[model samples]
Target: MKALYQYIKVIIQAFSSLLNGLLLTLKYFLTPGKSIITEQYPENRTTSIRIPERFAGELVLPHNENNEHKCTACTLCQLSCPNGSIEIFSKTIETEDGKKKKILDRWVYHLDMCTFCGQCVDACPSDAIQMKNNFELSAFDRNTLTRQLNRPDSRLEESNKQQKNTLAS
Candidate 1:
């Protein structure tokens, strides 16, 4: 009972000291036009917040000259994904040259399940795939997050044309 009385007294004294300090701080804070250390939540946005070109966020395949995705349907990326986020359905495609080549039949990716570890990017033999810096991935539906990226028939030729025009200019 005596120890309890002492503890209560100590606690009361500490609380009194804390209150005095807090009141002093609050006095300054209440002053008109006092500088605020924190900004309002999420009201500010600017172009400077963009990630650098080297900052990796998600992986995707580049396209070839024929407007086709460069993914050889190797399945290396699919196998390397830690969370099974990548699913590739591939089949043989015969070009005009009569050469059989692996092409993606279906490219299903669950971004919600992905950890973005970049293991799949490291495992790719072809310079076909790389991590892109698009991070605005919040979604309403989980099913819609199962995205289809780098369709087999991509507009690679248009990209090349744009590149050529940029180079020429």
Candidate 2:
């Protein structure tokens, strides 16, 4: 008898909640200012919802004179890379200060492999790495899209670094 009474009570509560929901839904339907907030996909993608300021973005490399990239191949970025996207080749050299220092041999930054976690930027002690807002990174062929920018003798490569340096300076 007690279980039957509890079951009846639950049924009544459930119906009551259902009716209340329907009433509220109907009230919204009948309200003067009520309007649909749904956006049309693709076409309405231009509309903005506020993104936080500290959002991680695409990577940016600092540059120096002679259009060389500013990174000394310190490998701090490589160490901090969560996805192992940045591969560096560095050589030991004697600087003007008469001490052994690591000079950057080559910076192989794989654009396709990056997760854009911004850990590299944060770990870079020389301010060599930064993040930019470039988000459109689609490609037809995956292999064709994995870019190793700043090849040794590429004009576009040097010019790109130089442009960044000029802007920074």
Candidate 3:
């Protein structure tokens, strides 16, 4: 008799659970076009689609209007990359006062190998690199994904030098 009672209790519980699900479905069916969680991706691409600011999409080196960047060729970003996605090539040059200075020659970023962890951006002391919100990273050729972050003939910004000097003094 206890076994039969237990079986009946389980049936009642199952029926209650089923009724709850059905009620939820009926509520959703009645309230059409309200509180929609589905986002039509491709159709809304150019319109109402919103991407969060914290989304780690693409790594980029921002250049000023004068085509100058903030990278000091410190290699901190390269070292912070876990997958070796960032490769920086720097060269030593002599200043006007004959002081040997290290400058950035190239800043290569391999988008294919990157995990979008944003550690490289965080490690940069000069704030040279940052993650942009552009997520369309698909490419037909793999070589295209291997990008140079710095623009051609770009140099370090003069404002960066002034800020460093002020901070030092």
Would you list the rank order by TM-score, best first?
3, 1, 2
lDDT of 2 by residue, 1-169 (tens): 9999999999999999999999988887788466754546456556744345666666767555456565646588999888888887777878587967555676777788888888888887557677876666678887864555444642223444454446546
Which parts of model 2 are misplaced by more than 4 Å? Answer: 1-53, 64-68, 93-101, 149-169
Please report, as a residue range, the 10-residue window in candidate 3 with the lowest summed lDDT: 160-169
Local error of candidate 2 at residue 73 (angstroms): 0.9
Candidate 3 overall Cα lDDT vs. reference? 0.92
lDDT of 3 by residue, 1-169 (tens): 9999999999999999999999999999999889876778888887868899999999999998999999988898999899999999999999999978788999999999999999998998889899999999999999999999999999999878776556546
Q: Is candidate 1 or candidate 2 better by TM-score?
A: 1
Q: Note the residue pairs that clash in candidate 1.
A: none
Q: Poorest 10 consecutive residues of model 2 by lDDT?
A: 153-162
CA lDDT of every candidate: 0.73, 0.69, 0.92
RMSD of each: 8.8, 7.6, 4.4
Per-candidate clashes, comma-separated: 0, 0, 0
TM-score of candidate 2 to 2 decimals: 0.56
Q: Model 1 segments beyond 4 Å from truth?
A: 1-42, 48-50, 64-66, 93-100, 155-169
**lDDT value for model 1:** 0.73
What does candidate 1 score on TM? 0.59
